[model samples]
Target: MKLLTCPLNGQRNITEFTYGGEYHPMPDHQQASSREWAEHVFFHDNNAGIVIEWWCHSASSYWFLAQRNTISDKILRTFPADEIFNQRVDFAPAPEVSSEAAPTTKGESC
Candidate 1:
């Protein structure tokens, strides 16, 4: 099974995750025709390069964006849940922080 990392916890697992979609946004509802809407909702772009995606951590009940290299299983970066729907590509890897930035021993760290 494909596993996603919780942007909050950093640990890799399945139960704590969900695949929202590749980070491409669709046109506004008012601007798109029915056919365009259908295509946007059902079709897959699957761009073969770096992709940003939303991963909802159900177990932790948090949402976040993850940047991953589609050609490789490498997770490039992750950001706060609220930043998922934003039209920003500045979501690159963060500066390596020491243990201070590590997930606190609060949640299940999954």
Candidate 2:
């Protein structure tokens, strides 16, 4: 059976982990347009070289990052997510529209 090391739990069966996705740095949320956001969320480079990716220890719910070779399908190393994402990405809720501006909210009383 294949094995994968968890930065927090040490070596474990690969079955215990979940492949999150490619660990690409997020785009500037404040400056990125809707199209850019769509592309970032939906697209993957699928590069053949070594790339950092997000992985989770399913049993413990511990998430981490791993460096893997796409062509070889081998994980080189694994580390905590905080090592790369030092800051959290918060999506601010859209401003609520007033009754005067939105027809849907005019008579809908909940």
Candidate 3:
């Protein structure tokens, strides 16, 4: 079994944690069209590197940010989920991709 280290606590088993998808800005549903909706549901960039993903500490009722090593399923770094959440982030949100830019998968949604 893999291990999960909580930023607030310490090393905890992986069973106590859950994987959350990549962090991105929520698109405005009202202004989004059918194509935009489809893109949002299916088109996500699978970038490899240190990405800040959400980790729910089911055993502790807490959330934290994890620097996930996507290639190996190994965690590089972790900290109190709120450390990144509470900070004044100035990062540009993901680009609004067109539906045509999405992959040609059969019926899977990202």
Candidate 4:
């Protein structure tokens, strides 16, 4: 079984945590268009590369950010959610995909 190191609890079973979706900046809801809001709420890159994501410890309900590789499923580092922007990992902005180029299915041909 895989183990995830919790910033507060140390190493623990991966099952003790919940996969909270990729972490991204939120646009101002009041000023954002319907498309922007929808994109923020519904779209995910799910790229087969390293990405930052939110994770919550099921037992303690502690939330944190994790820089993990999607293809290898390896977590490079973990930190508190508040450090998302100030983190020293130097994360680049997620690339935007035009609606015309977005993938539609799990196994659909590109």
Which tens-of-lDDT digit does each residue in 49-85 have in candidate 3?
Answer: 7676778888777787888878887788888755545
Q: Give the runs in model 2 whose Cα sits over 4 Å from its true position.
A: 97-110
Residue 41 of candidate 4: its Cα lDDT?
86
- 3-106, model 1: which lDDT tens digit per residue? 66565777766766777887667667556798998887888788887888777887777878888898986778788856645564443476798997786766
Alpha-carbon runs more than 4 Å astray in model 3: 25-43, 87-110
Model 2 TM-score, all chains together: 0.82
Instruction: Identify the candidate with maximal TM-score.
Output: 2
**Residue pairs with backbone atoms closer than 3 Å in model 1 (clashes):** 63-81
Assess every candidate by TM-score: 0.60, 0.82, 0.57, 0.71
lDDT of 2 by residue, 6-108 (tens): 9999999999999999877778999999999888999999889899998999989999999999888898999898887788789899999987897574567
- lDDT of every predicted structure (CA atoms): 0.74, 0.90, 0.76, 0.87
Which prediction has more favorable TM-score, 1 or 2? Answer: 2
For residue 59, model 1's alpha carbon misses the true position, in angstroms, by 0.4
Best by lDDT: 2
Q: What is the lDDT of candidate 2?
A: 0.90
- The window of 10 residues in a row where model 4 has the poorest summed lDDT is 83-92
TM-score of 4: 0.71
Candidate 4: list runs displaced more than 4 Å. 85-110
54-104: candidate 4 lDDT, tens digit per residue: 999999999888999989888999987766556444335879999889867
